[model samples]
Target: MSKALQEDSKARVKVLGSLLHTADISNPMKPWDICAYLADRCLEEFFAQGDQEKELGIPVQMLNDREKVNRCTSQVGFIEFVITPLAEQMVIIFPTLSFLTRNLSLNVELWAELWKNSFDPPTEDYEKLMARVNKVVSRCRAAGPWEEEAPMRQSSAQSLLSGSESVVTEH
Candidate 1:
């Protein structure tokens, strides 16, 4: 049986199992515009957990309450503490999935650049970055998914910083 076989309680198998997750690794391989829209919807859902908890007089858990949470800080911490480590372990377990972590690192950079008090209004740079994310997302969604990868473009963080959707296409 495969080491990853379910319910095989060997310590080694259990250790390997712990590394697995169905996490959305920063929407890699998806159209960026669609990914961004999905990300926004996901954010709304995640933060709403806090609002619901508060109404019930329950202590909101980490990442549950948006009013009390700092999106930037929460984002970086989640990436650094949770996603990055899990992704790294999974990469070791399945090296081909290293692709999952590439754009994830870029998102960490974006969030880190946007880091500020959650209560403070967004900075010009933060707003600009978000606009760029939405613009790329909108374009991709309108165009629909691609059959082939955009071979020439670097990471979106680079494109976001440069303000160009420099995805190369064959003419």
Candidate 2:
């Protein structure tokens, strides 16, 4: 893979790991077990906040095991969900947790900013919300099997966003 593609893949894994860590804490369950749970919760959260279509696209049904979660988004949209287990496992085996953690932190901060700016009441208090999320991430760190040192490539956000519309519409 080209250097840029390789770097992007590494970054995607790190971001995905961070997301799983958040889900694990929010639900306090094994990663596999949390898949449906996170999906449900995200649906509720996104819908309740008036961002269902904009943020989550649509309510896709749960996929059978071995089926990949579908995703799509346009230039004017946002999509959020978990990475696949295969991808998740790959990142967990990567050998640079510190780098991933740093990148995760920056991304989380950016997310918080977006959240703050998106709401009239500023929905969540960024610092407090992040602190709570961080607590879960810390637990994920202690749980071990950290995915570090893996080299991989990631699709562009634009590309990743493209396929989600079908998934969302199917629900």
Against the true structure, what is each candidate's TM-score?
0.52, 0.28
Residue pairs with colliding backbones in model 1 are 33-137, 50-64
**Candidate 2 on 1-171: residue-level lDDT in tens?**
236546798776766776576445432122212322344455455444544333566643443211232211110012112322222333355534334333332233333333343332234455565564464345344434445432221222222234321213321
Error of 2 at 97 (Å): 5.2
- In model 1, the worst 10-residue window by lDDT is 162-171
**TM-score result, candidate 1:** 0.52
Residues 42-144, candidate 1: write the lDDT tens digits.
Answer: 5667768878988899998876766666555455555555566565555555555554454444455455443422224568756664564544333333332
**lDDT scores for all predictions?**
0.50, 0.36
Error of 1 at 118 (Å): 10
